[model samples]
Target: MTAAPDARSALRAATTPDHERVDAAFGAFDLTTREGYAAFLLGQAHAFLPIEAAIVAADPRDLLPDWPARRRGERLREDLSALGFPAPPTGDWAPFRHRADILGAIYVLEGSRLGGRMLARSVPADLPRSFIDTSDSVRWRYLIEVLDKLLVTDDQHTLAIDAARRAFALFEAGALRQKRTKAFG
Candidate 1:
């Protein structure tokens, strides 16, 4: 058999920029200003609520074309506020690093439960009972249960969460760099 394409090639092929495709994805979802209220509720449930929205938000960069990192963070915050969550005095969500995983968990949970399937195991039992309150989405409830069952060690979990967090950071940096290059050129 021929050798398989490497990870870089696979990623490049998978992530090829297609504005139409991106637009279509967003179009599939009906986003209203009211979504902010949903986001606020999510935020009140979990300090890390923004992470889940960030994960699924339509073309986050499209939502905020300039000053990506800051704007992206702000949009998430706005969502939280709309959902009725009290903005923290510090307005910092990074203190809670579990956000992305929580997002991922919700994704899987929603997919499995609504679709009538399951994946990535269940949530662990030892995590605080408070974790389940993070969202009104039934998906979020299922995610809390799944998150509680993750088998990865704490170190591995930390690394995974860090990597996911860095993905957003790198995305912001790349967007900024692209803008600067266009401006200077």
Candidate 2:
């Protein structure tokens, strides 16, 4: 028989590589100026809006009943508007129709909640930060407790991990695009 899936450890291991890529890409962005911050928010908007729609469209209710509360696209949109930038024109994602894949996508968003406080602190004093708030550790712990109980097969686990990688790739691509594009005033 196949080993029982360990969602927490599997997800942790799956996302770490892409996580490092995202961190490195983010580090390259100069966040000190209004334009730089706008670009950053725009990149986030590109990634989050599409990924959020995919997770919602996949109807993650079964796996994540609290999925609605977990979305951060609105926050990204708020940051975009505050920075006088329009939303990204694209809202497409890689094929993530399966519940496992979609939940994997959602996991990236949920996990990002952990870094909001530090990211919020990164903005300069004069920057807009309506969307940058502290991570809700209570909610994170609750999600983790739920995830720990899931019993996916190794194949399903692989789908979830692949989705996470795709999610990160989407974000990294958007960030790179932002670095090359014109910033909103």
In terms of lDDT, the best-performing candidate is 2
Most TM-score-accurate candidate: 2
RMSD of each: 18.7, 2.5
The models' CA-based lDDT, in order, is 0.33, 0.75
Q: Give the lDDT of residue 87 in candidate 1.
A: 44
Give the 10-residue window scoring lowest on summed lDDT in candidate 1: 115-124
Our tally of clashes for model 2 stands at 0
Let me know the TM-score candidate 2 reaches against the reference structure.
0.88
41-160: candidate 1 lDDT, tens digit per residue:
232223233443444343323322321222223443554454455444332233223433433323322322232111112222322222222334453343444444442344434443
| lDDT of each residue in 1-185, candidate 2, tens digit only | 76664787889887898999987776676677788788878877778788888777777778778778877777777777877877877577766656677767767777877866788787887877765574788878766676665526777778878888888898888888887775522
Question: What RMSD does model 2 have?
Answer: 2.5
- lDDT computed for candidate 1: 0.33
TM-score of every model versus the real structure: 0.24, 0.88
